[model samples]
Target: MTADLQLWPIGNCQVSALLNAAGSIVWSCVPRVDGDPAFCALLDTAEDGNPPRGIWSAELVDQVEVRSRYLRNTPVLSTVLTDARGGSVEMLSFCPRFERSGRMYRPVAYGRIIRPLAGSPRLRMRLAPTKNWGDPDVARTNGTNHARYLCDAHTLRLSTDAPVGHILEERAFRVERAHHFFLGPDEPFVGNIGREVSRMCDLTIDYWRYWVRSLATPFEWQDAVIRAAITLKLCQHEETGAIVAALTTSIPEAPHSERNWDYRYCWIRDAYYTVQALNRLGALDVLEKYLSYLRNIVDEMQEGAIQPLFAVSGESELPEAEAEKLPGYRGMGPVRIGNAAALQTQHDVYGQIILPTIQSFCDQRLFRMSERADFERLESVGELAWKMHDQPDAGLWEFRTRSAVHTYSAVMSWAACDRLAKAAAMVGLADRAKFWSDRAEKVRETIEAEAWHAESGRFGASFGRDDVDASLLQLVDMRFLSPDDPRFIATFEAIEERLRRGEHMLRYDSEDDFGLPETAFNICTFWLIEALFLVGRKEEARTLFEQMLARRTESGLLSEDMDFETGELWGNFPQTYSLVGIINCAGLLSVPWSQMR
Candidate 1:
């Protein structure tokens, strides 16, 4: 069995140093974006997966103490371990430095593990890698002082400048005072990895510091907001403008249950909110790139409609399958990938994608003549929205077992048409403007008359069901109703009564449909923050915001769901929607309406 562990917070910083209870450095991912895992034991259990093939094992000592932290604002992670035998080991991981070429990009990763022997503790380091989710077809080749593991489409080379011996299980060992290992793909190790590592470390630190400096508010919760923002930024695939939902997937919503789903791809519905949050932070550059990415997808696809989600690089066909080989995190079975929701018809995609693109263009003041083609392209997209508005879609949740004419989905469809009408008028497409505007008005009338549940005094989840949904809270943020209107207040109270448990908010009760237990949706909690702020409850809003921020882990990470009963994180970690909520709420709290305009 693995030893007990305790994670120590690095001062007030958002980084956590994970150490065995006995005080040893076992696993960490740091320094560079997409760096190789230094301690990958967290990915799989010991019995079903191979351990790192290295001489560094805390089990060799009677007792150990380990601690770590980042070097200021940089991504570099530094860890130190001290053994009962008076021996100490320090490890550092960082990315190499490179100047960003306006078009092409190059990045490198560096890791160094150093140990000083005090009284012959007999140190040994083992290095072993299971290629492509621990498939056993890995091939290994020995180098002068290191080894290489190669498999189809993947290669890992470990080189050390110290004396090293190979073990029977394709591991490496060193008994000297100091040892270093360089690991990467078969690509040439170019551009002074060591110097680049130091320089890149400094550069990353400066980048984060400078970015955080631009924030207008250092509110009580600014620390958590900054960390969450940084993590969100890290999750963005720099090469492509896609923002993935999380770094890893298949973490169960309820331990030992099969509710785990892959979140490593971008979702269309998350586009507008994500861009809105970034735009509020004065990060127009990120919004611009993401909008360009959305346009690229529309430009490349033969069809006007969009999938629910897509790969970071715009790959459309992601086949869903189960990985029965490895036991899932916390024994959640049937780990899944390639979300099946992508195939579902989510009509909200029209508004979610286009409204944000239009918003970004307006926010960034990108009114150059060159932008006309992009504006025209969006107008073309609006035509597609007009066609989809009347169709029955899977709605926002992508319910698997049934379909309904979801009311929130229709509301967003109306929003798309309304934005398109504005865009058309702005560009002198007066005929198109009138057509979309008339259609939008009709939809709005239909929603207000048919979608509202008079008896319950709020918008229903769908025209078919009277149940209230957390999504209706968007009506206030989207400005579909006056905040102080009696009907709007009634709807807000109904949502709070039906969907909220204390400070935790559920998306909706799924017991009647999916048989899933009620859990807090992080995004919905932020919606409550916005709803409260809008409806003249500013103190209550700020109080709830702080409470939600406290729910984040020591490293300031939040998952998709939080267990209402235990306050434990459930579902996927570092969900994009959750981070986007944080950014949006922060903007509402920090920036005044005049400045926002």
Candidate 2:
């Protein structure tokens, strides 16, 4: 089967893998999210008479049907393969993660347990992993009860109870009993593999369940909210507290559109929204961890414009390049690696940084509250926001060849100063509170004077322009203008008229670097839903939100973009920005918890 957006993701925060319908680990990055793809068959399109390599599959002999789903409230995936003769096998896949030694034990490993469900099912295991962006298959070495594959700088060892010859030679074997496989760092088995894998599965399930139970879900759509929340958490690299935009990269926004770009690293703007959505559900753990990432970025930037994106490790330099070896998704070609967006100047990041950090000072529930020292460091970011709130830069959309004084960047800059004022008051600093408040007022005045389009009686996307993009809908959400304000109301109406295409919302109507966008951006559509509900268009908002929910993959997750006409989801898989929209809209549109009684 060809690679598609309908893939399942299983991860333990450190590393993740995307599995296809046949329960094959088709795409995964070892070491870290930004590392090389160890199993990159998702982008493999060999034309050299070679069958596609870099996939791990347990081929059920004469398989006739397949079905898969996530274990409730957990990231563990279970797939059942039914053969033509009515025999079936259940494959359970997950990454080992739980509380161990009084701390979190999230390993960079994958665990699979297979058992016969019906008659004696025969299985042929295909465990081929590639290295250096699908350029060549990894050299393998085998020992008793284990096989090791050399993955460039590191070795990936698979410790399994199945016969080594069957796996090495791709021979069919009978599944008379249960089998366990642990693929992780090169290491010898320390304990009984069967007992350990089983224990890890139970512990992992318990960990996810207990985590979900702590969430304060809305009265409706609890299941969808839980799933989106879990997927968002999966996108985070907990070790560094950076949340990636998506799991897979180079999945085109539209077929053969060359819109594909690597999304494995963190975009400051995207991470802010991720933490904000999770924070609304009272999942402060993510916010707390992410605050550390922001703190490091703030410190490192002592004085400079913060880039739009960064490596999860907090390294600033991310040079873009393409992996010519692996053909693109569906053989589109030109699969990209590192993102070039890191080189762009996106002034809105200052607000994104302070937006989440302000919560640290205000929310007393957090274990580590922001102190005066933290506020002092944040003032540096605020100073930059104040300095460049109205300057021309690559707006939040990250326009490639053009730069404009985007309304969104100005409003976010205003928000940075505005929130700092509130945080100062929370920390009992009167002088600094007044200082930030004055700066915020100045930035607000600038936006009102420049972004407001008097002729159209609505705010435009950028200063002194007639374009109305979906981002203008965020004015109310950012609190730059009240929902009842006539300007915000007019802006929302104008944006809907221009960007709304059927049930989907385009980021903009005008042509971009790749010409006019053909598919609707998922996050922008969610923004519209929120705007619709906020403007008292309750029924219409609910209907549109339902349409988006229906478009989700069978796993109840969304990608970055979707074709409005075909309803085909495109772009990166399990996009955090898209998932954040799910959680935010569900929280807004659901019935109040107080009325549930």
Candidate 3:
């Protein structure tokens, strides 16, 4: 497996896996996003004189060159490998997802189709899976045309049209025609494997293209926005309607800096941003599903403070732990599995829930609209926001050992009250609207009095502090302040002076739980670009945006962090927050359709 973020993601909204440049399956979890990894070779280290385990690769004998790309508008990948003798083979990889039997049929399966492209090409297929987070190869039983891998949680069966003996022995064989492989839940293959997989592939392609055609894309960067949108959609667990932060965990923020944490679970803050960006593109399916998830969380909390995150299954308790067997990405040890942030107090989440729920009450296109009972349930959440608006907790950065009355949290709390009033007005509850508006005004007055730092001529990161962060750049987007407000202009200038490193931007200048951040946070840089455009620096904003677009991997996606000096990507792969940035900036900066016409 390769040791970088130059990877492509393919999923069916149920499970996801990362493929290296050579088309090897390096990182994937079985069953679900947070389940035990069946292909953990991305973080695996080979023993002395031993080949790497936990990988699935189809290698061409005497391979000379390889080219890979995604099928237009779909997650299906097409990879071609050429051998020294001018022989070539193409492989199509995907997970089946389409409507079947009047419902969506997305199983825990991986499909591959290999066909000869030119001359006779020899191929070797190796499929090795591990259990207990890279401990040992799973036990298996073989059939005439398939193999059953017995995992701890479930049994995975692989049925194929290729020679079973050649696959089991990992021996090279000639590819004269097409071959098919389907690895999924242990069950009988009902029909001809070749014909069935081909049909699934065609239907899957149609499904993705239909979805893409429905997106309201910006005139410029339409391809970038679509890929980012697809990537974000793949990050969600459709069963629970919970969207994850990224596909992989423990890919450190900086080399050996130990800033890695598990991101497979759903964070309230991250999901909010994902929906907001997709909503701009008029992708309401994602927003509708996420709203369902928020309602479940609100029903359970019933006025209690919500955690920053939860599992895809909506499991609230995620105690942090480490996997001892696997070494880390590029051998940066201490690979963690769960996140401890769930136990911390993050009052900002109360507002995140309210922000999205308000849409259902106002939108006319949804199948299910918010009703009086829904409004009552939301009131409990708003009451909690009012109570915790000025309380101390970890801020959006999720600082480990620090607690402060963060200005961002307070502003979000105000948003909770502010949006609730608007929703109440829409639902024809004048008394309730006035009640929430009064609370919002009180919270706003307090934030303005305390968060503004006259000495620095800007709003501080937290109340009564001189420090500023990239999140402060969100005042305009959050509707807390107008873009041209004098106070906001002063704060933007201060942040630009403190955080901008060349064309990139850091989250902050000061040290926190980790010593000093060695890489620029990708979303922070995008936030800076938006702020620049708002302040009438249009040309400068466009230039910096072009620089960021150039930095994305060949897959048209970005990670969580970037090295400002070397321009290398660090942190987790296919970060949803970073993808949200791409969509948000493209919408703001792209030429209007009216002008283009």
Candidate 4:
């Protein structure tokens, strides 16, 4: 069987991998998440079982049974494969993420520990580290305990404790001893290989445990909350403070949908929700890093221009291109790399950029509170919001073929002005507060008048259209309308009738670039859950929330989309949007800690 995304993620925030159920390392990128996939077999069906080119698998010959799980509240993964004769081999995989000498020692690397579990299991180590999206094999030369693979200007070294001849020849051998392997940059191994890896493993485990301990998660759904939080943390590029939408490139949204897009970049809307979710868990590290990225963008766009997405390094131009070498997930072709949406004017970003900055102004708990300069800079963004609140742009759904004056975009604009008004008041600038407040109220008036489809008694998706969008569910979350408000209920009912598909929620059922959506947008489903809760359908909300949780992978993770009919996961792995849903719903549904005691 090929690799399924019932996978585990191990990373130090610099690099990550998705190990599938077959005990094979499937999808992993190098240098950074947006960089080339060194092991790209997750999408290359031509090399499914041919491990001569891209994979790292410890195959157990005559294998009949296999099982995998994370090592107890940690990101470290352990998998066991048993052969027909009850012989078994266990593999433990993790990328060491720990503090060393007053610095985080998270490298662009991975480490694995393999040993016999029962009956002297036979093993064939297929550590084929390829390059050019699995199209070329790197030239390798072995030493006594290490092998260096040279690919262009890059050199990767794999240090192992197993027999070098067995690894190079792809020969199976009966396990006589435990082995350790570390595949990383061309660097010398410090001290004994086995002892060093063991220590690193211990330190990594402790580090993750401590990080998990620090989370201010809700009382219930603790496992789900922790896993989601950790996954979101992995999505963060700590060096530049950019949070990616997902770790993968072109996993199609639906079968043959041709809607596949690269999601590894930092989207303003996606990042905002990610930081907001992490912020709720007291993960300010991600927020603080992302704020740095935002500050740079703000300086670059002194006139308040912003893109929908950017490279994690804050590069603005992410031109979309297809990789013909790799087949898409399940042979869905047109495997894409960069995203063109970076150039499209996604106006909702103006507010998303400001929303997090507003936190720095209001939160007294932060060590570095916002100064007058910060608020003044934010005012420029609010001015842009005021000017462009009703302008036509690529809406949040990012329709490639069309642009419109999206209601969600306008409401987000109103939110920016509304929040800035309060920030101004907090700083005792009554005049500025009134200025922003007036702008906010005017924006609100425009939304109420234009976005409302009066004959239908509902809020429409765009100014002139009578469509109900699932994004409307976010109106309550954004506090644009209170649950007690009649307009919200009517609009929500309209969405329920139009977008809800049994237990799933589609972003919209309308035909787009690839016809009608064949799956539910996972985050939108969570929004529906929140809307249900706010509308006093608390029981129904909890039921739906549980149903959504049931769809998560064996690793307690989710992809970007889910099949409405079969409930199968689709799109990219470890989606920040879906992870945010888990955190938001858990926080909303969990019984109060005060009452729990």
lDDT of 4 by residue, 239-285 (tens): 89889999998888888888889999999999999999999999887
Which regions in candidate 2 have their CA more than 4 angstroms from the true location? Answer: 1-3, 47-49
* 355-385: candidate 1 lDDT, tens digit per residue: 7766643443543222457667776666667
- lDDT (C-alpha, whole model) for all candidates: 0.63, 0.91, 0.91, 0.87
Candidate 1 wrong stretches, greater than 4 Å? 1-43, 47-63, 85-90, 95-126, 162-181, 191-193, 214-218, 363-370, 512-514, 590-597
lDDT of 3 by residue, 1-597 (tens): 123778989999998889988898988898998989988888876756576667899999999988889999999999999999999999999999999999888889999999999998999999988888886668999999999888886678999999998998999999999999999999988799999999999998999999999999999999899999999999999998999999998999988999988999999999999999999989899999999998898877834689999999999989999999988887886789999999999999999999989999989899888988899889998998999998898999999999999999999999999999999998899999999999999999989989988887789989999999999998899999999999999999889898999989999899888898899999999999999999999989989998999999988899999999999998898999999999999999989999975
- Evaluate model 2: give its TM-score: 0.98
RMSD of every candidate to native, in Å, equals 5.2, 1.3, 1.2, 1.7
> In model 4, how large is the Cα lDDT of residue 118?
84
In candidate 4, how many Å is residue 531 off? 0.8
Steric clash count of candidate 4: 1
Query: Which is better, 1 or 3, measured by lDDT?
Result: 3
lDDT of 1: 0.63
> Which candidate do you rate higher for lDDT, 2 or 4?
2
* lDDT (Cα, 0-100) at 460 in candidate 4: 97
